[model samples]
Structure formats: C-alpha cells, structure tokens
Target: MPRPARTTPSRRALLGSAAVLSLALGGLAACSTSEETQAAAQSTAGGSSTYPLTLTSPFGETTLEEKPEKVAVVSSVDLDIALSLGVVPVISPLYGEAELDPWETTALEGLGESDLTTYDSTDGVDYEAIAAAAPDVILATSGWTLDEDYEQLSKIAPIVSFQGADGLTGMTWAERTAEAGKALDLAAKAQEVVDGVAAKFEAAAAAHPEFAGRTYTYAVIHPEQITYESYDGSDTSFFERLGFTLPAAASRFSAGNQAVSRENVDVLDADVLLVGYPFGDEGLLTRSALESDALFQQVPAVAGKHYAVVDDLVASPLAYPTPLSEVWVLDQLVPVLATAVAGS
Candidate 1:
C-alpha cells in the first residue's frame, strides 16, 4: 500500500543522474524563489484559513498553526491528493527518476512542470533536501517517516505523519486523503473526492450483479520464488467495497500478506484470482509459469482461467488505495475483473 521506507541498496543505486541533477537544480531554483513564494505562502497560511489543526499519528500529535501554501510531500501518493485538491505541493517525491506515472501524467494536467520540485526518497526521507524547500507544512502520510525522521521534519514545519497502524503502509487511500484535506483546510473537498470513489464503486457493483457474493483474492507472483503472496486490507477492501467477499482461508492472516508455496497454492483459491507481476516480459513469463504449474492448475481460478494478470504500474495504485488512483484503477480494472467473473 504505502511505499516502503527501507529502500534496498540496488534500488538506491538505480537513481539516475538526471534525477540527481533535477534535485540539485530544484534546490537552486527553490533558493532563488524562496523569498517571494514563502511570503505569499505565509500570507495564505495565516489568513482566513483553519489554524492550529492537530493530527494524531503513531508518533504523537502535530498541530499546524496556519494553512499551508508551500507544502512539501514525502509520500508519492500525497502529491496526487494535493493536486486533486488544487493545492500543488512546492516539493514532492519522484517515483523513481520519472516525475509522474502514466496516470499522473493525465491527472496533473494544467499544472506547470516547474511549479513542483521533485526528490528521491528511495533511500530514506531527504531531510536536507526537504528543508531546502522551506515549506509551511510537510505531508509525509505515505512515506516511510520514522520517529527520528518525524522529529527532524518537525523542525522544518508543521508535519502530519501517517494516520494508520504504521508510518508507511497502514492508512487506506481514503483515510490519507481525508487527513490531507484536514491539514490543508479542504475537508469538504476531500470528502467530495472520497464520495466520488464510493459512488464509482457503487456503480461498478450495480453494473455487475455477478460480482456480488463472489470470493476473490489478489496475489503477487514472486519472480525469484514460485510462490504467491496473498494480500489483505486495502487490496481485499477494494473487492469487499464492490460486494465481493474474501475467503476465510485467506483472511486469517492479519499481517496483510500470507505467503503460500507453489505446492500449497490452494491457499489462494477463490472464485476469482487477480495476479500481479513485475512489468514487461518477466511478468508474462511468471504468469505463464504459474499457469503451467500442476499445483496451481488445481486451483479453481486457474482451472477456469478466472484470473487476470496485472502489471506493476497498474497494480501499485490498486494495491495501495489513493483517491485519484482509485478512480483511475476502477476505470481500468473493473473490466478485467468483470471478465474474470464472467468466465468463472
């Protein structure tokens, strides 16, 4: 759901030179524009806006004394929520080297490329780079912000930590958006976005009565091992919201994920199975391998071909639940799931 905070060394090593250059250049740009932007942001932050907004997280409570204009977001999903609320963050984390994902490319229309600064948080929260932005408030709801990181960020501005079980991954997309709205003094707008997604789910269920009473599970196909990791919570919640039930066998694991070996693939058996794979040919090969496995073939979903293979790009937002991403996901995912159900 939320991006993991502890990025592996290989991932950190993959940071492109261009992203580094952008961060370097963005810092320089932020410095040159700080005085003017900060002045304007302060005026908005203090004027007519809700102040002393307090949000409680696992770490403790953080109260924003003013409405924030210069907001900095460490979590990648928060940026999307900010944009949807018409508040462009002064600084946001980059999704790897790319400034935006495919869905974001369309969602962020009319926003200037230069309006936002981007940084890499794969290794950890970039306190120094974030401090450079000089924000009035920091949104770290979706990032891996530890207690130590929270303490450091507090020195920069009023910061809202993740509002769920853990720092990085607990909050549902709706919860995170609502929290962001409260912090930004746009509670009504946030509710509207949440309502919109709820309505979409209702529409999907109404359109496909067959989806009702069906049991389904979404699993990740590990590239290295011939195993499936079934995820609960947000991933299952998506289906549950649409009137599907998660099988009890898969629901007992409250840790969000339950790993099942290939020989024990029945743990993932359900009326429908949605498999996610790494992007490209590797994903296809993995899907093929799973399909060809005799043990996997014994599962009802596999036997009936009542499964859909989703790529990483499409799976990320669905796996983690965000307002904009949820809407985008429904548009692209419903048809696939519907097809799987029809076959089943």
Candidate 2:
C-alpha cells in the first residue's frame, strides 16, 4: 500500500491540504479566497488544545511531553482517525496498510504523504519494528497484546492505547478522533471532523427517508463452515445512523451472535438481508453454492431477490466504520440497498 519513498511532508503542510479538501469537497467553490478563509479560520481552531496532554489507557497513563509530532497508528480505525486529522503516521500495522480503503488513499494523496512504514502484527506486537520507528506517539486505539506490550511500547514513546476503559472494546470513531485530537493538540479541528461527518450522515438519512423504519439483518455466509453468522442487531447500529433498524424477529438471533445452520436459515428473514463473505472465504461462498442448497433457497429475502451481498474488501471498512470509510461506502451502498428495498 505504501508508495515510493519521498521527503515526508510536515504535519502542518498536510493539515492545510486536509482542511482544503474538507471545505472544497463539502459543496464550496474552490478559490484562493475560500482557501485562505479556511486557513485563517483553522489557525485559531486547530491549535486550541494545550499539551503535555495526559491521556489514560487500561495499562497506565502516558503523558505527552508536548504535542505529538510523529504518529504511529496500529489499526485501520486509528489510521483513518489520524488521517482525518492530517497526520500520516511514521508507521502503522501491516494488515492496517493492506486494508487501506480507497477513501484512505484519497486522504493520503491529498496530504501528499506516502511510503508509510508498517510491521506485520498478525500474531503479536512487533515491538522492535515499532521502537525502530521512534514515533512521538503510538496510536494503538485498536492494538493487540497491549496488556503485555504496553509497558514495553511506552519505553519507545507514550502509547495512546484505546480509550475503552475496559481495554477491550476500543474507541468509537468520535472518541478516537477526540482522543487523538487531545494528544495532537488539535481539539477544535477534531470536533470539526466529528461534526462534519455527523452532518453527512444526517444529510444521507434525510435523502433516504424511505430507509427509515426499514427492517434489516446482517450476516456472513460461510460456505466452508456451512453456516451463517448473525451479527447482533442493534437499534443504535451504524445502519441505524442511516435510518435502518434490525427486524424484531432477528433480535432472537442477535442475542447469541450465533451461527444459524443452513437448515434454519429462515431466521435471517427481514425486509433487507445484508450479507458479507470473509475475504478469502468469498471463493467458498459463491452465488451458485447458495442456489444448490434447497433450504437456503427458501429464505424469504433471498427468494424475493431482496438481499445485498457486499464484497469483503468494501465491507472491511464497515467492520469499524470510521469517518473516512463510512462516507464513501454509504454513497456506493445506498443505491444497491434502495433497489433491494424496491424488490427490483
């Protein structure tokens, strides 16, 4: 995912470009006056927070000696949040780099930043590689093995582990953005990012009033496993932000987050059935594979051609919808879903 190495642009320069993207892309005409106006507005807005910012994690409190300069993020969520704030990390997790959605590439190119250093962390933390990067801060909002490695990582730089007090759930998009803001001393810019995305969601929901009160269900159909995983339906779900809700009948399956057998696949019934394939597992679960299954064929939504199957690459971002991924995905997904709602 890393392009060729070039001189790393300073964060301040990237910050200006990011601000320009936000305003110019947000329905305003591009002009010198408009660009200068945003720059002037952000001079006061972007630096409102004071540092030696002290942030807490389950492991311990890590205090920034001053605002962090070189950021190293370890998860896609953290990477997206940092990019939203215009800081291209010195390093990020390797899997995180592989999962760079298109929106993230746009953000990186917008900042004129590239060739990020990343280490494979599939098994555990690569403490040596991370230490070698010598980051001003490590944004581990969704990192792994932190309980064991937090103290070790702290030796390299202050680790901003997930804001989740329990050290399990990690931070939401807003929380991560806000926390990263505090560490970077860009609290006002962070809030603007949060508010800006919230406005986009609101606008989407307004545009798709028909999405309101729609009943839906989500699952991963594993042909190899021969089962369907039902994600717990939530009233306050990401889909809910776009005015969709899980079906009441689906609530029974949601409680267990269980794998419904092919025989019992009728339980996935809903006005809209949103399906996902595991990245490699897509080969196992083909359209014909489902058609050959007699019982799976009877599922109401599928029978009615009212199901939308999202490719895993596209669905990966929604696994933890950050500010960057959600906007692009919504634009692409809504039309397909609206068609499903219309029953062809």
Q: All candidates' lDDT scores?
A: 0.63, 0.64
Model 1 Cα lDDT, one tens digit per residue, 1-344: 22212122212122222113111111112212243433432233223336777767777677787776678877657777776665667777654444354445555444433335666654667788888889988877765545657778878888766765654655677778877878877777777778888998999889989899998877765433332335444346677777788777765555534556667778787888888764324322356677788887888887897878764556556655567778778888888888898874
Worst 10-residue lDDT window for candidate 2 reads: 18-27
Per-residue lDDT of candidate 2, residues 22-94 (tens digit):
1001111111113232334345545765677777888789888887767877666677887787777767665
What is candidate 1's local distance difference test score? 0.63
> Largest TM-score belongs to which candidate?
2
In model 2, state the lDDT of residue 40.
41
Cα miss at 230, model 1 (Å)? 4.9
Query: What TM-score would candidate 1 get against the native?
Result: 0.77
Model 2 stretches astray by more than 4 angstroms? 1-45, 95-99, 120-123, 165-167, 223-236, 255-257, 279-285
Worst 10 residues of 1 by lDDT: 18-27
RMSD of each: 6.3, 9.3
